[model samples]
Target: SSVSVVICSGDSVFLEGAYQYSAGTYFDTLTGGNNCDSIITTILTFASSDSSLTAASICFGDSMLLQGAYQTTAGSYVDSFSNAGGCDSVVTTNLTVSSQLSVQLSSDTTIVTGGSVVLVASGGASYLWSTGDTGSSVTVSPTSTTTYWVNVSDSLGCLGTGQVTVTVLPAEYLVYVPNVLSLSSVNLEHTRLYVYGRGVESLELIIYDRWGKKVYESSDASATTRSDGQCCAYGIGWDGTYKETGKPLNSAVFVYKLTGLFSNGKEFIESGNITLIK
Candidate 1:
């Protein structure tokens, strides 16, 4: 009698009277019902199994799919399944979880109108700004108060977000008036009372006597030449003289009113006292 059998690796099968553990032809002697010694032949074959090893990594806070389960930590995993040859296919995986990626955005800032500021981001492999710029740093010139956002990405494709706010101050003009005018001074500049400042578009300065009578008045809104040759908006200030008669007035404290329109279309009115020292 002859028989053929197939078994998985590391498995055994009983053939004839003895056990067979490997793939090969075997001969055994068995006693039949007639009490005579009979010879039996067995042909054994093995279905090969497979094994494999792999390595994988993922960012922190993220999960990796290993076999039929998801892994979140670093470790070794094993899985087994039947292969096409009806044998066990074992797979071993070594997973590594990386640390978290952090990102820091620049601090908030203040800037005047039409001014620009530089924003920065750190601890990221790449950066993108709300202004459609891509880099570690970006320059922004916002006309009004605005909030900016940034998105940072790490090498592993992890993403982080941060925000910053910029406060924009409007363009403004300043005015400085003299409280005393030295009419008899040797310096001709000090003899005249002039308004000092910048951004003034139009100005009207009027001086009144103690009896509330209009004395000196002027409409000069031209800017004064600075020491560095830069021109700053200023108007010819009050002089110790009477407007009706081009004559010097006596030394006395007088009331002055100043009104003007700024280059930004803002209006201002100021009242103060000035002393004339002849």
Candidate 2:
């Protein structure tokens, strides 16, 4: 025999020899309230489950992969997953993104003294140089070696600083001395020979007659220090005259000794014969 009964959705009922009962009717043998053999039935029902979660934050211009798919736009996404109940569960994800920050400066460079070079900054909304300027590029001419720094701010208000060193090369040295000078007429003071070069520290020239007698000498030629700190550059020189009376020397071949010091601490000594015209 069969009996009918109502049950809530997803609920299960039992039969005589079965544990699971579907939406169909079942028969069971039991001692009804009358203590006699009777039949009863049960039915079962089930429902689906789902869930939602927020995804972690990610940087701008970067993508996130979910369930073998890539996504960049910020929004809600859904994918099916197997739950412990052996059912397909729907999972929703909400994504959040942020902006990226970057900053950089030009590489280091080498320059000679009195020479200038341009430095550039990049990957920023604004820039400020250590030299008190605000711009994307700056020109620097340092007497000696120096390092310059630039502070950069990104669109997201992120700040970064970078530096580049500028190495300065020493000044060049060059000089020229005349082999002969006239001491008579218009050549009096014009005959004076001053050290000449791009960087002359100090120079001293002495004159002597054929007899080896010192005819002219100026300052301490051996002094390590020069009043003018440049190489091949000095205003002091010999006027082709005697040391005592400032008298012009006679027209003759005279032996001269020259000692020069350079700004770089290098020294040179030269001795040669110079002709004097009377």
The TM-score leader among the candidates is 1
What are the per-model C-alpha RMSD values against the true structure? 16.8, 19.0
Best by lDDT: 1
Tens-digit lDDT track for model 2 on 96-139?
76655556777766555788999999988889999988999999
The reply for model 2, stretches above 4 Å from the true place, is 1-171, 185-189, 220-233
lDDT of 1 by residue, 3-117 (tens): 8878899888887466778899888898889999898888899998999998888888889777688889999999898999889999999998877777787777656689899
Q: Model 2 residue 25 lDDT?
A: 52
The worst-scoring run of ten residues by lDDT in candidate 1 lies at 226-235
Supply the global lDDT for candidate 1: 0.82
Cα TM-score of candidate 2: 0.32
